[model samples]
Target chain A: MKMKLRNFIILIIAVTFVSGGLFAQKKLTGLEIMKKVYNRPSPKEMEAKLTMTLISSSGSKRVRTIKQFIKDFGKVEKKIMFFLAPADVRNTSFMNWSYDDPNKDDDQWIYLPALKKVKRISSDSKGDYFMGSDFTYDDLGDRNPEEDNHKILRMEKVNGLDCYVIESTPKDEDYMYSKTITWVVKDRWYGVKKDFYDEDGEYLKTLTLKKAENIKGYWIIVTVEMFNKQKNHKTIMHLSDIKIDTGIPSRMFTERMMKRGL
Target chain B: MKKRFFTLIISLILIIWFGFADGLQITGYVRNYDGVLLNDDMDFSIVQNTLDLNFSMQTSKVGFKVNPYIYQYSDKTTVFDVREAYLDLFFNSFDLRIGKQQIIWGKADGVFITDIISPKDLTEFLLRDFEEIRMGVTAVKFDYYIGDNTFELVWVPVFSATKFPEQGSIWAVTPQFPIQPQFDFSRKDIKPSIKNSEIFAKYSVFSSAIDFEIMGGYTWDADPVIHTLKQIDPFTHQLLSLTAIPEHHRLTVAGGSFSTTLGPVVIRGEGAYYWGKYFQSEDPMLKEGVVEKDYLNYLLGADFTIKGIKFSTQFIQQYILDYDNFIVNNEVNNLMTFLARKDLLSGDTLHLELFSYFGLTDEDGLIRPKISYDITDGVNILLGANIFFGDKGMFGRFNKNDMVYVKIKYSF
Candidate 1:
């Protein structure tokens, strides 16, 4: 009985040491976590391996694996590229045109190999499917934190880590959603949960990040699940073989890269 | 094979050029609609699986727009129908477009609606008219600024098609009378076409509290109607025909509108008056006598958006003076009144719409209620029904079997 008690006491001490040490390592509120994440210093250019999966009611499953590069060009434009899967679309070459707008909605375009043509699309259709993936054009576009009003709701322990819950509302009435709520990890600055509301202020959808594994010193979400509250439908995204800070070139995001098969 | 190779080479050149010196972009989408109505049998055949394709090509040197669209049904096919295709040239505060485009010139609700003298949907609702494309003669438009106000001048030295190209194509023409015979199709095409010229000025005043715009314009159309009698019979001289017009049509219009916010209320309203000869014309229904000139259309309405409820109403009169003429023949006038409100709920929304048309001729109206609910993320379900009462025959357009419709939409 004495030995068992000693073992239990040692286990408790180790648990306390770990938990207490984390709090001392960083004393941060939910809002502070959001601010830190927004201000993280990393490479201005990055190339990542991405895997996306689409699930439909008819038991249809589509899996896509691609290499994507992101480049920041001040405020004028933040360029993104799909080096692989854009051409892997039925195994044909593809190209896309997109721009970041300062005053109005951004524009997008896609060149289909089968059609043998380049098509222009309106900005209002940002919610449409992007290259047959679950992610839409709007989801791919960069969202500036300064453009929205943010309110930190509370803090909670989520998936063994403390996180901050915040709500963000856009000032523009023409925006697709009225408000968005997010739960971000306190230390990693990664958003793990998100809720989207429609223009009429109704809860429309929720996105949950399941795993954040450190791959090559980069904290990345390996799995994400998006559930359509009304449609009873769900989409899951999983990323594997991820590498960060691969010295991506700015030229890769240009229209030339899109035209030339990756 | 050569053509395909050429296309590939051109695409590559464009891509490389864009990458080297400011990117060139070509963007567009196809808008396809699958339409369904409550009364499935009432011939919702107007629009079926219509695909509207839009494309824009932009470069550092120039911007190009090409919209080749088609509306298809199970049995019918319509082609080409380019709404707008133009090259845009921008310099300083001025930009010029040469090709097919849309122009806005009026202020009245019906003038904002059905009375627009443009190639457009004939009976589109006021809010829905924003999608109409107006086709006119090649016009040179200049925009000038005086402080916070703007003045515009548009000159058209040639005539243009004011009616939609497809209007006369699928009209519910009256069956030919055995004794009189139907109007000849060839006669309507006879054109002594008139030139159109217009000038308009708008003053936009803005402050932190309110924003308002006042505008006025005058237009002269060289086409006017004249009554002439050709001796068909001396004793019973039936009015031979209205001659093809080539007379001066002068019009003057003025209007002002303001948008202001008071506490939680946002008020927006506009009113306008049209006065002059040839501004309004009567339907050629009377067999013998002269028709009366009247107000084209006038409207006054305001809306309130507070909390989560939106309420609005409008009072309108179309051809008020012609009401007596139609009343004599027991023809229903098109003057309409409206009141609508939408209530926002937590996961659903409720809407109520009411309409009433009052004139010397008869009574007619419609009332509709709709309810929509969000069942899950990115999915919505809607149910709505329309009620029609009053003169069962005159207002029977809405009474098309008193439809009840349900729609399910899932958007990503």
Candidate 2:
């Protein structure tokens, strides 16, 4: 009878420890969750071809084709984009170098075939649209979690997938958006959808990851769509021919390469 | 004529060769320009059409490019020209190019300070696009890379002179004299020889936030100095015959340029010190002799964009060392330029631009305002006007040449 009582106490202790551990995991703060989302494992080098389709409210459409290459250098990230289609913009290329330090602005350059020259450009405003697309320059780059304040609003299901709804407000009042609400999948840790509000607390744009795929242990967004509510315009981006960890050389990110359209 | 035929045959052979290659690309544009002189009582008109073809082929170790242009005028005249034709051989860390090419230097806009390698076509002055005005020269170029720095060397065996407007063209400059001297006028230009070959070298470093380059070159001035040789009649003290010889004098240029971003603005500066530069003297006694002087030219420019509008401004100055009293001009000349561009429409299909340059020393200026619209994927239409101000100097002398023009271009 004494042995039976001891077994009962042991059972009680095991149940309590297991339940407490699960509860602790669920109690993770919004900041900690966002840090995980921001620091997700990414490929050191990647190359991709993107097709952007711009749709107007009147049903007019324009298409652009771009080839992109990216490389991470620990605290610094370098990217180069080359326009491949639309005869008018063919051979035009853009290069950018982003630093991890918040005080340092990205360095950008553009090469115009007509001029046969590489022009250094200003990267002061991240809110400017990129290449006539619905996505701003900031949206195309990774944003540091420390730049904003995040709060876990609740737990909900997005597209039938369990998600943690988090709201982030920019620390700078002069930022382009007032706040953003994101729905991140619990298991995948992928941001499936996000809604941006203007300074007046009005819905400005909605960004949705239409499709994602798991390739070689990496989860990558294959298709994305952004809709601008104020302008009633939309941009759909389709990424294809993606290559990860290809070991691209650092020399390929130079101005000479930009001019060569390689 | 034989050279022309040979070039045509070679271009055809290359086209055929690259046509079957795996990575060959062919692109071009067709453009038409209709212009009318607004200040000339609408009597002067210009109608021209051009078709340009660009061919390129690239492999792992070699590349080739060629650009040919065909121009047609309203006077039933047609001309064929080759803009650039080059063959590139790539190495592990260096590349060599041979043939006719256009090389650009410096960071200033609408100004020439350190950009002196390629000759220019002054048929329409600054009204023409900069790319259109640049004329390629046959040369061999080599570029070697070291880390983020590059060393470039260029050699041009033949010298090319800048092309001026035709004698009867609206943009022509007729030399004015204080007296109506009755004499025969003749002009001659010096041709290039082995001793007059041009050479240039530059070292450039591009870093994360800044890029800078230092260059030096030995070449003949693109613009020739006119030397007057007059023969006067001994009996009437009248001029009998005059010969104007245009000579390309040797010049040495050493300069450097740097560009960096400061906050939201891009700041760029370029300066060059020219040795043995020829300047025109207004004094009658020295008119027949071109004065030689060493001068320093510099430019500072900045560009920024705000709310989808881009604004750029530049200040340029030229200082002549050891100023001569007989030069009859300021030792320092100043010029400024401002450019603005804005896009309209949701897709940025419509653009408006204004570019203006002012001569602070001479009180002369030029303002060009243009609007462009993309009708389709590869089709564009542009309308613009060139207006001039001042009563003297470069821009003022062309006051009567104010014009309004329309351009339509189709690319494929």
Measured by DockQ, the strongest candidate is: 2
Candidate 1 runs further than 4 Å off: A1-262, B1-49, B59-62, B72-79, B105-118, B121-137, B143-153, B164-170, B173-196, B205-208, B220-248, B262-266, B277-296, B303-312, B318-362, B365-412
Write candidate 1's Cα lDDT for A119-179 as tens digits.
2223344444444444555655545566677887888888888877889888788777899
The C-alpha RMSD in Å for every predicted model, in order, reads: 13.5, 8.6
Measured over the true interface residues after superposition, the C-alpha RMSD of each candidate is 14.5, 1.4
lDDT of 2 at B370: 99
TM-score of each: 0.49, 0.91
- What is candidate 2's TM-score for chain A? 0.88
Q: Residues A135-200, candidate 2: write the lDDT tens digits.
A: 887776666777799999999997899888999999989888899998876745558788999889
Against the true structure, whose TM-score is highest?
A: 2
